[model samples]
Target: MSASVPRLLVVGGNGFLGSAICRLAVGKGWDVSSMSSSGKPYATPAGHTPAWAPRVKWHAASAFSPDSYSTLIGESTAVVHTLGILLEDVGYKQSVKSGDVFGLVKSFASSLSGGDGNPLKSEEERKRGYEGMNKDSALTVLDTLISTTPPTSTQTRPFVYISAADAFRPVVPRRYIETKRQAEIEIMRKCDEHPEAGVRPTFIRPGLMYHPHIRPLTTLPAFLVDLSAKLSTASGLPNPFASKSPLHGALESLRTYPLHVDHVAAAVLKCIEEGRGGVVEVPEMRDWAGLGSKKKAEVGLQGQ
Candidate 1:
């Protein structure tokens, strides 16, 4: 808890998660700046920029260009990396079809196989092809952050990475999990390298998130869960509703579900305020859950 207003630089601030973080930070009186490829004011669905947008500065930068974001990182008291891609764009696909894929694959194989290529080039292609883009981007960002940031000041500055809960599980694809795992290693290494910098690196892995303002089509998990429940009930099978975890079930029950966008915002603020910097899984807002529990407890207390 620094006495002065903390400055936060959020990467990919125009994105869903990033924008939510920005809104929450501004509410908490933090000086927020957002960097995006477009470099334009972030507009909400209501056709207007949020009030916080006026107070926060915006930077146009590309993750591929380390120099673009280096200065911003230098000035900020904290940095939150909210950037991730589930699929490659057309341009990226075209580049991979060119010679870059082979070059990258060769380099990756070299690091693992001592330049022998004994496992065979064809084998490497089969194993690493699906993961090249994600792995490369994650590694590039990690390297840029570690190399460009001032080693001395890092300890005092916290780096929070928003990850998915599935990232910790073995069931998740290597293509997805490997990228996050590598980023974790990079953060840990940076922290170890600059103990004096006082930079604390932390990760927050939230399960599927649902906001009413967000488009329904954009939320695949919620849609799927609801669809599955309906189809199962129509077939006259045992109601499969309660079998799912509370998080997923709550999302499926959109109409009655109580999770609000503000609650998620509050959770992010709580993490930063407490300075509990580490991997926090399922960081749902306890306040909302507590209110419900309090009502039930009150009934029991009165009866007793």
Candidate 2:
């Protein structure tokens, strides 16, 4: 990679959205570094998939503990925290088993917050998990970068935070959305208060995301999900969207203002490239995803 190119550090880079960002960033010629507890980025044959693994530098680290990757963070021009959990349980365990490193650090912090060493077993435990992983982790990364890694210039370093659009979704627990909201509140407050900290925190709230292959098949189901998702906000319905059934989950992914996984990933890169910061809701997601004027117009009609 060219030295003039910007360097990016993606926490949770092995996950669904983070992997996409790395692929796109590599294509853009940015020097990319991915940090996760697992320390491995997804890879496939160059012809079989987009060849991004060759270009990215992967590191093992916990998002909750700044010290794990603090030294590597100093030289990055941007950092994206795509850390979150829809719900906590067996699915989360499976992710860990796959070496996802998605929320391990946050889980540890959550445990500490609850004054318990045991895994999440109660509502209170779950709340602490969301608080530590979803809210505090973002602040921790920003704090680590600001304190340890001064920007090379006066320009604020971009920090992209991936929050959820379904924070108000009825079927899901309120704690999930509330914790994410808390994260946004604390992060934006820090940005507002400390302009010289060299951190520009950008929050991207993505709608339900799905792979393109399955998306086209779910247009009507997705529409239904969207309607239900809207009512969910006011009704405060319990979110059952986390079903392990492949068919159920695939269809459920359409609800809550669905976007393709690639679109979500593209939005993050666009934020960093444009040096934009602040909240990016569903409507703005496509624009940043580079859907162009025509697609953007269609997205607007969806009223996401």
Local distance difference test scores for all models: 0.57, 0.69
Highest TM-score: give the candidate number.
2
Candidate 1, after superposition: displacement of residue 144 in Å?
Answer: 4.9
Cα-based lDDT at residue 259, candidate 1: 32
TM-score of every model versus the real structure: 0.63, 0.70
Question: Model 1, 152-212: lDDT tens per residue?
Answer: 4423666777654542121222345456666677777767885655666777655445564
| Model 2 per-residue lDDT at 84 | 76
Name the TM-score of candidate 2.
Answer: 0.70
For residues 38-61, what per-residue lDDT tens digits would candidate 2 score against the true structure?
A: 897665322234456868998999
Scored against the true structure, residue 143 in model 2 reaches a CA lDDT of 82
Minimum summed lDDT over a 10-residue window in model 2 is located at 212-221
- Candidate 2 Cα misplacement greater than 4 A, ranges: 1-3, 43-50, 92-128, 212-256, 288-304
Which ten residues in a row are the worst by lDDT in model 1?
A: 166-175
